[model samples]
Target chain A: MGKRRTGTPTLEEVAAHAGVGRGTVSRVINNAAGVKESTRRTVQQAIEELGYVPNLAARSLAGRRADAVALVLTEPDWRQFAEPFFSEIVRSLGDALVDTGMQLLLTLVRSEGERQRFLEYARGGRVDGILLISVHAGDRLPDMLAEARLPTVLLGRRSGDEYVSYVDADNAGGARTAVAHLLERGRKTIATITGPLDMYAAQSRLRGYQDALALAGLRGTRSLVAEGDFTEESGRRAMAELLERHPEIDGVLAASDTTAVGALHALRAAGRRVPEDVAVIGFDDFPLAQSTKPRLTTVRQPLEEIGRAMVRLLIEEMEEPAVAWRHVILRTELVVRESS
Target chain B: MGKRRTGTPTLEEVAAHAGVGRGTVSRVINNAAGVKESTRRTVQQAIEELGYVPNLAARSLAGRRADAVALVLTEPDWRQFAEPFFSEIVRSLGDALVDTGMQLLLTLVRSEGERQRFLEYARGGRVDGILLISVHAGDRLPDMLAEARLPTVLLGRRSGDEYVSYVDADNAGGARTAVAHLLERGRKTIATITGPLDMYAAQSRLRGYQDALALAGLRGTRSLVAEGDFTEESGRRAMAELLERHPEIDGVLAASDTTAVGALHALRAAGRRVPEDVAVIGFDDFPLAQSTKPRLTTVRQPLEEIGRAMVRLLIEEMEEPAVAWRHVILRTELVVRESS
Candidate 1:
């Protein structure tokens, strides 16, 4: 089991340097009781001298590691549950973790107290690794976990300069593709339902929409852009606002499938035919897209692959803590359907 | 903290009985080393004779318990991810666990190896309690958990004779109400699309459909029944088969909203209008019910309440291991809309 570490020092080496038995070194590393204070100090000195960082997989092989990872969702809002994106990502991540023999512990930290408690639990070696999703730009969890020297991975980065390992879909690229397709279809008055601008993904998507309109020599006006929080009702209300501002809008790009469903409903109620009167598209081609009447034409983010990538990256870091941080950007494609 | 147990033996009493210090009793109960072997043996004997179950909440307050719970989903199919039911329940469960400060760990065991590994992990005292969902009749998880004496609560029962504590909705009664509503609307030829019969909930729903028809002096025929696995595709296929067998059928009761959505699609393709040529009713009035074209008139199950109830029961069992097993049956209501 220790042979996997090619360049790393073994527990036996640390024990030898500390002039203690291997079991003593193991107990000290695992923070288990029974080690004498003086002997533990010697082991710590040896570890510092050798710059020893425990190989997570090797520790598990020795039956010291917990062999569990925490998937943390910190959104306090229960309304987020209505969006199927998080659940789908969780299922995919669970499937990816199945063959790895590691259990997935899902932690939802809503308040500062809960966040601090979870951080303490993770720092105390309750879980071997952590996967954070739906993290906000202002969240300190990623930094805290990194500071604790815990092997942590993020589904999406909190900011562009994120130092933590993460995997994210090309939100901007998907939005650009949606807008470009609408332009190609000769839709003169294109509009977009943007998600809350505070979110990095939402901000990037809005940029893409703006860039696409700029390329077509059309200024993306404020009147053509309405804000939505990625819910159906928000989308409906936003669409109504957009129509009142620009009734001639012939193309729509919603930030999410639920929002698109709402846009479709509002358009239908306003007596406009989909694709004929106005072409509509959505992001995240979840099952809701297929179940819609016109069958939503949307950008399909590889959610399952994104989940698998997070697991793979986190495992790599856990196995070799000295590895550098990685940021993977997965591509998204447009799924053409009746609505577009 | 020990003062909370008014009737139960306090740690101080146990320590006195064992002729040891209170700290020694605490160390022994927490399995913290440093106590002499003889002292640990005496504390164990005193605890056994005194029938001390160790107040879990008090233990947690003292920062002794792991303060974590596991939510297990044993369904192997990824298609289950598309169901909004699981997501909503998870949200509610997460909300319920918030004030308790116990983190929720979600485990999806898909294979025999995974199941065995999870059972061992749970039995090893990794998590304080478990909340299981989507378990099948043949699954031994509930029984294994019960045998391990771990505080466990299930979302639904495995069978009629299930000994584990559970919270379930009135599936049969909801089905009967749906059918009776269809009958009141003067639908002469009513058919049913049932979920897989292996699940007790599905069986109960089919029974209710038959009972409703029987009450109106009409015998349910083989041609009027089609089975689905509670998916839209299965629902659509079942509806197609039912239509082929009984083209004159004027009413349909689907076991789930997803299935009913499929039935609506198939009916439309067959040139049949909903509630005119056929009145369709679905169970589980999720958000998808409102998104459909004509909308779905289905049975509204208190999914969030069910989640809270499961959490309440599991916490009770954890706080008092000797408490009697509880079986909570929640009520369901019919939500009328355009479909029926």
Candidate 2:
């Protein structure tokens, strides 16, 4: 093996050493397909031996893609940043991009000033595209990126009429399934603890709950619903309020697993035994669901599939630049456990 | 507000619109100091109004920094990616970089081939610096990065004799404090479940356990120690084996919170009453600590402080490449709860 040279080696030297053309070396360096495996290995060996480092900055300036994507968090709440839900999404997205040779840049935009700063960063050609997660209704960052001609994909939509490309789990369908399962267990009087209604996912979940009750020929009264922010505290508060107002309720559906955990605490405090007095179900089968007392029956979102679909759509839009905006919805399943 | 023009706008056009000099606009765009706050706001307003996007690629080709940092994960185990430890580090790092106008790029290098590709990417100047986490002993990527003259910082050291800059907690001291607490609680016959010894953190923790026992004038026999890999399953297995081998053990020290939870499970299965028949302590007072059956008494590392120190050191090194490498060790405190 040759010792590393004090001076940098050029592409031509690596090509000559590998006994291949300069183009072959360049293709191998860029990770472009079509190069023979054996030839690629030979060129990589020569490059390693000579310590030849390609100038990505120069390649990018010469009209080549940066081969990077930005996963920007648009939520203003810092607490959400530490949630397991966020971690799951990031893990899945990182796994999805591992083989694409594109780096994932994580950004947090909490305020309008930071949003403008990120817009400039994205438009500056530092990334091939952008992936926005946790975007709330009325957020204009997505439209701004679209106007700037940057390929952008979102993890969830702001509304049903979202124009930007997005990949979302079937929130309504998942909620409907959860409620239907409760009905099948012979629970006639049911109530719901919903997430903050500003988000479309929360709205869809509420709609699903209402639709399930209607389908069962049960009247979903106004007193049967309470609002939560998908937080444990909110869930507890909502559950307590529902218990106080409607003591006859025998079934409860929480919009999120965290909320369900809170409701469990409230039920225990109120002297209600799970599945005996009041059966419950939650959404987003988080890891915490399995650890709760009596466990939790919840709706499981296909998070990994959602992450992969978002990446695929973004890459397609980046390559074509004129591809129509797409909306892909993945299915969710019910994971039954002790609570339900 | 003026409508966005069809053609791309230049820096000169932005300066003309803001009624400022081209150099003034350039300084504002680069986020360099010396421009008045009012002038900076005016230039920003003009840039946003005209939809002017700076070319970061050309700026990099001109020898300017990319103003981005890479947070690389060298761990090959995919399961670790979803751990709360990883999420906390990423959240803190992102928060640290938010006001600095530097984006955080996340990369996972699991295989040797990916390591070589990352080397070329770093050498190509895609980022200003690197922050590595979960590096195992004898990992050569850090040294390779150092040889390439990149500003790098590690969350934890590969070994005590690490030459690269890093920020680590007082792992040994934390462990010693935990064991000392157990001793002070009048518990003799104590045993320890150690983390994988290959990791410096784990080794230090084990050393601390032995030192505490020796200081207390008790024999730290080999039979009182079992090794684990910081996973819940490993912890459960190690604790079960220790119980079977030495049923007289009255107290236990687990290397991590997850491990402690597993120990709790094992103790429960064996019908050992905590703090009565047996007591347990854990490290890394993670969120899981507070929610455990009896709640967990564990050591709390200053994770946020460690993150801020790492970012500060990396920025200093990037600004002055000649700066001497510095090692930062933050203090840890013990949080006592019902478990102990």
Candidate 3:
């Protein structure tokens, strides 16, 4: 990991071979940039001929590229990490970038101060590009970044339509499929537990459920519905509330795996057997799906695909700014286990 | 976000403030090596005042840092993301770096080629540093990274005196506390379902169990020990094995929350009531710990703290290379719930 090579090739030697500046030679080898046309080629050629591998430890002393990227989470609660969706997405993103010879940086922003500071840093060229995850609606970060026009990709779409690129799962379609499955199962007493509706994801999922129910000629039933904030407790509370309100409920749909977990707990506590007494289905096929006594019958969003798609979109936009902003929606598969 | 205060600030402001040549300003800001020391400072001061952030987004333009860090997870299974450990560590690491004005980049390198490519990207200045997690003993990536002298901080350490930095929990102490509590409860025929022992964390936990047994003059019995890989399915399998080997075992200890969940399933499947016929304890009190039927008595590693520590150490090392290689060991607490 150094500038050492056979024949003691100078920066000049490398530049001459690659037809670029000594600086360009340094930049490309160090994965830094700013060198002009044909410069990178010359430098790369020189390095290949001389078999020169840039030494990271020695590079700091040479006053060159630090060669690092930071990954910002932009979330606060520590418990948020336990969410399988987040971890799985990060894993896939990291794997893809690593193959590209890039590093994965992780950061979490809980407040406006941190957000501003991070934006400043990004503007300061502290990062090559940013991979952002924004949970709440109406967060003004996307526009700020867009105006800056930094190479940034978001986990979710901005609330409004100012130019930006993003990758998201087919949350609505997955929910519709989930609801359709329940309808096909012919559980007349269908019910639903939704996540925080403020989130576009939650809203899309809710819409999917409604569309499916409407197709089956079953209208929305308030007594058979409850709102959860995507936690097991909320799911449990919602399920218990549903049971209290409609004891005859035989089919249930939850927005997430955690909520479904809560549904399982509530149903079990109430002495209701799954699928037999009250059928259950969940989304996100989180790790918990299999551990439950009656394994969860759920929908699996292609997490790796989501991550790769986000990176792909970001890189595409970064390469060609004139390209129109794109929205990528991947499909989801319903995985049936014992519960349903 | 307005275009008036555009991302590319005035270079004249930088020149005026730095009190250097327009040529020197070009050299320093563009990262040319010929700029003198004093000239560099002036240009830097000017650049800072004008808020002249460098541009990395342009397809052809190049200068400045990547502003991201790569978090490498050595785990092979993508589904393992459901485990809270991956999420908690990632979130904490992300939180710590957010305000440090760095973007977070995350990657998973499960194969040799991928690991090599990541190392290349990192050494190539694609990232600033790396924070790694859940690496196994047999994996060569850790050793390769260390040999390359890449700036890396691990969530847990491997065997031997490698010079890499890390932040980890006091697994041994935590295990001792859990086991000691079980012993104090007067439950004999104790059994333990441990994570893969090849991992240093797992080994330390096993040592804790042995230490506790010895303190109580109870020789550690192989018959009561079964191995798990820190998943619910593994715990269930181990529990079943332990039951077959030691039918009269009345107490159980699991290395992780998932394992404990599996043990609960196994106990119930065998018609053994929790805390009545057999008591159990688990580790890493994830949110699910509270939701477990009888709840779960588990060890709570300051997962967030470890994340913070890893980032802190890596940043400190970056700022000052003279800092001693540190092994930051955080505390772990035993949170008792109904299972015990």
Global lDDT of each model?
Answer: 0.85, 0.88, 0.76
For candidate 2, the TM-score is 0.80
Task: At residue A199, give the lDDT of candidate 2.
Answer: 91
The DockQ values of the predictions, listed in order, are: 0.13, 0.42, 0.30
**Order of all candidates by TM-score, from best down to worst?**
2, 3, 1
Residue A309 lDDT, candidate 2, scale 0-100: 97
* Model 2, span B255-292: residue lDDT tens: 99989989998999899988788889999887889999
User: Residue-wise lDDT of candidate 1 within B1-340, one digit each (tens)?
Assistant: 5546433477788989999898999999878989899889999999989855454334442453457889998888756754777777887898888778677888877778878778767754567799999878998988888876778999888888888999999998999999999999999899999988888889889998999999999898978989999988899999999999999999999999999999999999899998788999999988889999799999998998998899899989988864689899999999999998
True contacts kept of 3: 0.39
Error of 2 at B323 (Å): 8.4
| Model 3, CA-based lDDT | 0.76
Question: lDDT tens digits, residues B1-340, model 3?
Answer: 5545434665555676766656677678657787778778867878877767543433112332455677877788765665777776666776788667566656667677767767766655556678888877777776676665566788887764545788889999999999999999988888899988888888888889889999999999987788889989999999999988888888898999989999999999998999988999999988879999899999999877887888888887666643567788889999988998
Candidate 1: deviation at residue B164, Å?
Answer: 4.6
> Candidate 2: what lDDT?
0.88
CA RMSD of each candidate after superposition: 12.2, 5.3, 6.9
Weakest ten-residue segment in model 1 chain B by summed lDDT = B55-64
> What's the C-alpha lDDT at position B61 in model 3?
21
